[model samples]
Target: MPLFRLDASIMPATSQSRALADLVESEWSAENPGAAVVRRDIGSEPLSATIWREAVTGGFAAEADRSPAQRTALARAAELADELIEADAVLLAIPLYNWGVPAHVKTWYDLTYTDPRIAGGALNDKPVVLASVLGGNYNPGTPKDGWDHATPWLTRVFRDVWGADLRVVQRQFTLVGVDPAMDRFADQAAEIKAAAEQLAIEHGRAIATQVQSLAA
Candidate 1:
């Protein structure tokens, strides 16, 4: 009955993604009191950049022929895979950086893909909520439309690739108030924030219910 939560925000204190995730987690907590929660803050405790390479190489070599680093990398991959496999539900809070997925998050995906079970769709039919935030608006018809390279990729991985029963809660224009130049979008940002927050809570409750049903 464990829930796995992963946060990938370098600035934890001021992270809008983390803020949204907190709302989701709060709702989940209300539904499942005292339930186990496993957390991994990749931004604060990032995996080694070389782990993916080492694990990939290790996969091709005999156990006795594998280097120590490769062996360690493979073991780490298995551990990451196990975390997700054992969880009843998962919540991933990630933010867009430079219009793309953060480097550390990408590394995590790469390393985890080394595990045979994960790569083979271990999360199939599992409940997952992806809470993501964007610094600027990237909706269609906006100036930055089509510039968002993170969400689509994330959706593909979580929904299509892993076959998760996925729900996405996303907020845009998160920098409207922070950046003076974007003050004109304050009202729009407020609306988007409100909507995203509501969705986060709803998704949280939905996942919790689904998990409880599965357990029952």
Candidate 2:
């Protein structure tokens, strides 16, 4: 069975981000019963501060060249990188924080993209699907809409650093008052939720079908 990795970074369980993630997982699992689905809740397991530091350091260090704490941190980062490399597909549920991805999600990307061994040319040809939920409406040519920084940054990282072909399906303008009336917000949210689920399922099926084709 092929492995599908889902990373959810939303702090609250009922957060819009988690809602999208769950919808994706549920729909995909329903379609592919034998497939392996693994969930990583970054808010709960939260990467250590050292991982962020190592990201700043450029790469991991030798086992014997560091304190026990540092070694453990390096090991965790390596494990995450290995998981990413081994997975056939990846789903990232990103929620906006101050006009960008949450801090932990950014940290995860930092760790994922900084490893010289796992990165460089190794990530070539990998496929990534991004599901982003934003609090405000930033749909091109609005007053507050100009502040959207999530998709662009994600696209650059997936293509430039990870060497992956990335597709982003997003749900934006979730916050109240972003639109004309509050009533419309509920409708839009529900619509976005449905769209996100469908996209996730499509992404899963597409990746699985691709893998099957490769094996043939």
Candidate 3:
């Protein structure tokens, strides 16, 4: 089985989201030893931000009437979409930036969505694990409640739009130890991190089990 993994962290060396994703991926790999894993690091190798606009226009234009840029953009969109379409499962390691989705992730989704296969629900029922992290707390009753604009949007796209069997693992207060101002929450942060890590392990094993059952 092929697994498609996308990392949207600009700082992979110290990315909490990537750490969680690693757990999930390791379990999947253990279950299917030597399985192919396709990786796309959009944060480091970002897509052309302008390509999405060109792709949209290209979709409306005739082949002969399309500009060179438009043709190239459309082709790129197809390539991005093909990766997910061909995958048996997917893992997205994304961190909340500025209380919302990273610019690179947004651009990637925009360009990929222009592809007909994805728009037609090619990812329907595909298993997707989204490992997301936040530097601050945003739970209900907290000061930042409802401030996270990334998780809900991500769920909408994956579960509602793409029809994926999505499982989300989120870790909040990631900056508790790193940021001096949040030092007061060290104990709470540790607890949250531990719980999230455990969830990551469980979700990873579940994904592997689910995929193996389907293959059987």
- The candidate scoring highest on lDDT is 1
Q: Please give the TM-score that candidate 3 achieves against the real structure.
A: 0.98
lDDT of all predictions, in order shown?
0.94, 0.66, 0.94
Which runs in model 3 stand beyond 4 Å of their true positions? none
Candidate 2 per-residue C-alpha lDDT over 1-216 given as tens digits, one digit per residue, 9 for 90 to 100: 445454555456556666665665565566557778666778667776567675444344555566665555566777778777776666677777787766787777777655566666566776666767887667768666668777788778777877775667677656654456655677666776577667766775665565566667
RMSD of each: 0.7, 3.1, 0.8
Q: Rank the candidates by TM-score, best first.
A: 1, 3, 2
lDDT of 3 at 80: 96
Candidate 2 worst ten-residue window by lDDT: 54-63
lDDT of 2 at 4: 46
Q: In candidate 3, what are the lDDT values of residues 10-42, reduced to their tens digit? A: 998998989999998998898889999999999
- Candidates 2 and 3 compared by lDDT, better number: 3
Tens-place lDDT per residue, model 1, 1-216, is 788999999999999999999988889989999988999999999999888999999999999999999999999999999999999999999999999999999999999988999979999999999999999999989999998999999999989988899999999999998999999999999999999999999999999999999889
TM-score of 2: 0.82
